[model samples]
Target: MKIGHYTYQPGARGGIASYVRRLGNAQADIGHDVEYLCRNGEGSDLPSVREVNGDVDLFETAQQRRLDVLHLHRRIRHLPEHRVPTVRTMHGNQGSCPSGSRFLKRSGRPCNRDYSVSGCLWGHLIDHCGSRRPGNVVNNFRRIETEHELAAKIPTATVSRFVKERMIRSGCMPDHLKVIHSPAPDLNRPPAPLQHKDPPRMLFAGRIEPKKGVEWLLRSLPKTDVPVFLDVAGTGDIAYMQKVKALVEDLGLTGRITFHGWVEEADVYRLIEQARAVVVPSLWHEPAGLVTLEAAAVGRPVIASQVGGISEYARDPFALQVSPGDVDELAECIDRLALDPERAASMGQQARAIARDRFSMDDFVSNIMDLYRSTVTTANGLMRR
Candidate 1:
């Protein structure tokens, strides 16, 4: 099959980019003719690529390629419905709650909920009070309409059941929606040996945004006495980073926390292997916490919030689930893991078992391939009839 994958940013080190890269490569390995389409094609990894500018029409290019299927990784507007089947993967909540994180609103926290049609109008009116650019308003309006249109037109796939449920509640067609979790690379390299290091370390990876609960993690650090060292990875809003630094200092946790901003994928895997336990204190509903799966795969237990799809994995014996935004509870959980080395080790072992049994890369790829084949076959039968 001639598969065409579409992405907004090919070189981006975001989760969506990582997923498409792995999926495209895997499909090519399985003898499928695969091509990836992206804007600018900025990444060094994607060599044989088609570069697209703002003026270029995607539908024209897709038709020219005679693509059997066009798998879009981003929420695009006005996709031409050619004879070929097209699938859109919902990586995040771009459509449902406008804010993307429904939990943020439910918790009465400040979030980006003012992106819907009504909110866009209000935002423009409030521009007199603040700074709302014309482009931002136009973009929001377009995005909201595009989301509704796309939801009705194309078959959609989500990475987690949490996202699927949200879409359904938001009026997406249940029959057209599918849940296909993203797969990790095999990482053929042998697992790093567990090294005995003093000052038990906890790792928090992914973008340093408020939704990720990085600030909560920082606040919780001072309360723990297990001599914890936190390694914070990934890059995000510069202002948020500054706030985190200030909080760490205010809490007198300067020496305990290390901000290793934006580590590469290989380094991230290594850090997860070395850490005593990985922490994901997300204040929002994480569609699927990919980091948790990666941590489990490396034989490290995870301490994640009990929200969204995170509860599915974090409830396992290897995981320590805490309520979201509960700094006190999060700190206590960290301390518990840090003080009891034997229990941590046992949890790590169990985590590895869970990863091997449920989250294997081989199984993930196989399931996706099966779905694609089945969808294509069914579509063909309908055409014949």
Candidate 2:
């Protein structure tokens, strides 16, 4: 099978890019021709590549690729009825919610606002949603409409049930929605020893943004009865980073928090292994918090927000589920786990066991390939009839 993928980049360090890299490699290893179609070709891992120049049209380009299956990792163009059968994966929340987190931009609260012209437009203008700028909001509205139309017909899937539910509410047909967990990096690396940091260090290893609920995490840190060292291992915009730095200074948390701006994936796994627990305090309905799975894959317990798919993985044995943006509960979870090193170790073991049992990169790719084959078969059948 000659399978091609469409995403922002081929092999960047982001979650979606990592998936594309890993899956494309695996598919190629199994004797299938895999190509990553992006604005610029960045990696040599994938066997084939097709770059989209600025003036090139995607539909005409896709037709030229002559791919047996083209999987739309993210919404690039609205070529829904292109010559090829395009399968979509709702990797993010943009199509459904304008803010893309399904949360209020100003309040950092979860939002269930159904997509409506008055509701979303006014929500962006008056309500606490992000992008108050008319230009950005108008562009988002058009994107949302394009995605809705695409979802109404395309064979679309999501990374988690939480995301599938939200997409359905936002107009994705329930029948079109399929829940599939994205491939976790097969760290093949051994799990961390039971013994961990004596004072219990916590780690948050993703983008530092408003939707990440980083401020809530910082505020909750002061409330924790026990001292917990937090190592944040990602970078964001300068203004946001400065704002968070100011918050850290104002809260007198200078001694407690450390920022490691943009480390490699190996370092991320190392940090997760060393930490007592990982925190994923997302304010949005995260399409799927890959960080939670990454933490679990390394045998580290996760303390994640109960909103979105993080809630789905943060169960008793593997993690502690806390309400989104709830300072008190998040503080309690941090303190409770920090104080009990033995229990944290036990949870880490449980999390490792869960990862071993559930997250199989090979299985993930095989299932997707199966979907691709089936989509092509169905399309061929319809054409023959």
Candidate 3:
């Protein structure tokens, strides 16, 4: 099958771009003709990946290439309306929530209300759900409306059941939505050895944002009897980063935590393998936690928030779940993992097994291929009719 993957950038940076690269390459490896379509970038070393020049239209490119399927990872204006069979993967709550984060600031709980001017605006100003910028607020609502329109027309795939439910609440047709869990990265190695050193070490990697619950993690540190050293990697939201840094000082956790800011993907995995455990303390309802999947792939036990689709993977012997924003519970989980070296190592082994057996790349690609074929067949039937 000829497949064209579309995203905002050609170079892999964040989760969507990384997934696009991984999917395209994996499909290519299995003998499918794959190409990447992007707005603009230096493009990558991958020869199949190409940049859509300013003059070239995105839809026209798909037509000229005669692509059998166009899988969209990012929201583009007219890509879904093309003659090509298109499948849009809803990676987050962008279509349903104006803030793109279904989190209520004051209460620190996931918001279920569909997008609206009055309610979301109140959320921004009063509840502190998202940005307070007047222009940004208006633009976000318009973006959500556009997203809803596209979702209604095309086959929309969500990363998890939580995301699918949110999309349904936001008015996407039930038949239009499909839940496909994000694929686990294949580390292709046994779980990293547990270095049971003094002051047990933990790692937190991903974009540093308020919704990420970095503050909650920091707060939990003081309560832990085990003085676990946390190494935070990845960067986002300068203002929020500053707030977290300040809180580190305020909580007297300056000596215990080190902010690595941003690091390459390889570096992240390296850090993950070195640490005794990984922490994903997201306050928001994560559609599916990629970080949790990565930690599992590395064969490290995870201490993750129990909210949203994270529970789907970060469960049983793989991870110790704690309620979102509960510092005491989080700290307790950390101490349990830290103090018991044998249990932590055992959990790491189970996590690796989970990654290999349940969320393999081959299974992920096969399921996607099935969805693509079905979409193409449906489109062909409509054309014939």
Candidate 4:
């Protein structure tokens, strides 16, 4: 089958971009002809990218190529109506409000709750009538309306059950939505051997955002007795990053915390393997925590926030679940893992076992192929009728 994957803004180094890149590669590996139609230049890693300089006349090219399926990875409201089958994966709640919030009023910090009725209504009003800036108001309304239109028009796919539930609650058709967990590269490469170190190392790999709960993790450090060193990686809002640094200094944890700017994918696995445990302290309802799976692949146990789809994976023996943004509980969990060397090792082994069985790239690729084949066959049958 010939498939065309479309993304508007690529190379953001986020999960969505990573997912498309991996899916494109997986499609190639499975002997399917796939092309990534991206607006933000050509992807260096993916061999199947067809970068378009402008939005004009792109659908004509897809039609000319006779692409069987067009999968949109990003929001493009101006997408031309196509005769071919189209699938849109709703990665998050990008329509109701800004990609981050569900309400119009600013919290002055990130709010982590799932969509609320009042929040949604407030956002809609602010977008349509309340905002004084006419251009901004019009843009927000258009974006939201486009999302609703796309959801109504296309066969939608969601990355997690959490996201699917949200869509259903927001009045999307359940029949049109498919829940396919995003795939991650199988890091079958043997993990670096554990070193006998004095202080156990904890790793947090993600953008340094308030929603990521980086500050929560930092605040939790004061209660832990073990000599815990946190290696924080990734970048985000400059102000938030500065706040994190200030908090660390205020707590006199300057020595314990090290901020490593962005690291490449190749090095991430090694870093995960080296760490005693991985922490995913997300304040929000993370639809799916890919980092947790990545850490598990490296035989590293995770201490993650017990919210959203994270609970799906964190129930395993290797994972320690704590309430999101609970500094005391997070600290205690960290201390327990750090103090008990033998237990931590056992958890790591268990985590590796889970990763191999449930999250193997082979299984991910096969399941996705099954979905693609089924969708194509159904579309063909409809056309024949």
Candidate 5:
């Protein structure tokens, strides 16, 4: 079958970009015709590509290609209902929450209120869920409303049940939604021997945004009984990074923390392999913590927030789960893993087994292909009627 994927710039570093690249490549490898309809086509590893430009309408291009199914990773307005069977993958809470994160800033807790103009406006201005700029708030509200409308029509796949539940609250039809977790990268070699750093290193990889709860991780570092060295592996939100840096100094943890801004994917895995534990202390509702899965795949014990999909994997034996934004609990969990090398090694082994049993790329692609075929067949039957 011919599959067309509409996604971001070629070889972008985020989880969504990595997912699209891996999925498209796997589909092509399995003898399916896969083409990436990307904005930037240079440096792509895929076989067929067409750079989306303003000169040609995207719907027109997809129709011309005559793709059997079009999979969307980004939110585009006005999905075609006729010839092309379009399937949208909701990787985050963009359509459901105005801030794109179901987190309230002032209260520092997950916001459960459905999207309403007055409620979200109060959240932005009073609760501080997002920017206070009137124009920015207005734009976010409009975008979410538009996406929610489109989600009702198109077949939608969410990265986790957490995301699907939020979308349902925001008016997406329950019948139209399906939860498909992101697959872990194929680590071909056997799990490496657990590397215990001298000071018991903990790795935090991903964007350094406020919702990521990096500040909370910094706070937890000083509270841990053991002297845990933290290595932040990616960068995001300049202001938030500055705040985090200031907090490290305030807490006198400057010596223990190192900021390595936005390294390559291979380097991230290398860091994971070297660290004693991987920390994912996201304050927001993570759709599905891809880093948690990656860390598990690398055979490192994960210390993640018991929020969203991270809770699904962060069970006993494989990982230690902490409540979102709970500094004391996070510190205790860190201490538990950092001080006990034997237990940490045991959890790491269990994590590797979990990754192997679940999150295989082949299984992910096969499931996606099934969804595509079912969508196309359903659409054809409807057209005939």
Candidate 6:
């Protein structure tokens, strides 16, 4: 089968890029020809990238490639006349909410105010959905429209049921939308044995954005009685970054919290290896908990916000969950896990077991291939008719 993966970004900067790389490799390993259609970025040397920057590149150049399945990792402009079968993997909440966080900035919480012209406008004007700028609101409406168009036009897959439900609530057709959990990392290269730390260090490894709730985590530190250190390892907006640093300094947590900025995937795992627990304090309904899954693969328990898909995973015997933006609860969790290494180790074991059993790359590839084949067969049938 000739399969091509498409996204706006060319490089491995975020979780979706990791998804593309992992799935592309698996498809190629099975002898199915694989290609990635994206605009080349400055920092990456990824292969099979057809460096075009806009809809023209995808509509004209991507169509010329004549792929059996053009799997999109995000929403893009596609005229109704375009014929190639496409499947979109909803990696985030951008398609459903203007903020992409589904978080109401006015109230400072996750919102379910459905995607509507008035609702979106009100969100921007009152809630600060994405930005307060009217221009950004106009663009967000257009993006939502594109999401609806693509959702109605082609097959759609989401990384989590939580995200799928959000899209459906925003008027995406429920008939074709499906949930296929993201793949776990290659765990076959010999497992990293579990080793607990003495003082305990919690790791937060993602963009320090509005939705990430890093500031909330920082605030929680003042209440925690434990001597544990927090190693924050990702970068984002400069102003927010400064605010975080200032907050850290104000709390006199300058000695306890270290900003490692952006680190490589190898370094992430290495840090995970030495850490006591990983924290995913996302204030938004995270489309999927890829980092949590990654930590699970490394035999580390995550203390994630009990919102979005993390709640779904937290329903089981893995990952400590706290209410989003709850500083006291989070502080307690830190104190509990940091002080008692045995329970943390036990949860880590459950995490490793869950990652291996439920989130395997083999299962991920099989489900995606099945969808691709079905989409191809449907396209062929239409042509024959």
Q: Mind giving the per-residue lDDT tens digits that candidate 3 earns over 233-266?
A: 9887888888889999999988888889888888
TM-scores, all candidates, are: 0.88, 0.94, 0.93, 0.88, 0.94, 0.94
Q: What 10-residue stretch in candidate 1 is worst by lDDT?
A: 105-114
Instruction: Give the better candidate number (2 or 5) by TM-score.
Output: 5
Model 6 misplaced stretches (Cα beyond 4 Å): 80-82
Clashes of 1: 0
Compared with the true structure, what per-residue lDDT tens digits does model 1 show for residues 32-130?
Answer: 888878786876476456765531366677778888777788766566644467777888866565435544433423233434456535534442211
Candidate 5 wrong stretches, greater than 4 Å: 54-56
Model 3 pairs whose backbones collide: none
lDDT of each residue in 224-314, candidate 2, tens digit only: 9988899999999999999999999999999889999998988998888879899999888787788887887888888999887777666
Candidate 1 local distance difference test against the native: 0.75
Give the Å shift of residue 118 in candidate 3: 3.8
Tell me how many residue pairs clash in candidate 4: 0
Candidate 6, position 51, lDDT: 64
**Each prediction's Cα lDDT score?**
0.75, 0.80, 0.84, 0.73, 0.84, 0.81
Candidate 6 clashes between residue pairs 3 or more apart in a chain or in different chains: none
- What overall lDDT, based on C-alpha atoms, would model 2 receive against the true structure? 0.80
Q: Determine which window of 10 residues in candidate 2 has minimal summed lDDT.
A: 52-61
Clashes of each: 0, 0, 0, 0, 0, 0
Clashing pairs in 1: none
Give all candidate RMSDs, comma-separated.
3.5, 2.0, 2.1, 3.3, 1.9, 1.8
- Per residue, candidate 4 scores C-alpha lDDT tens digits across 192-214 of 65544868899999988767788
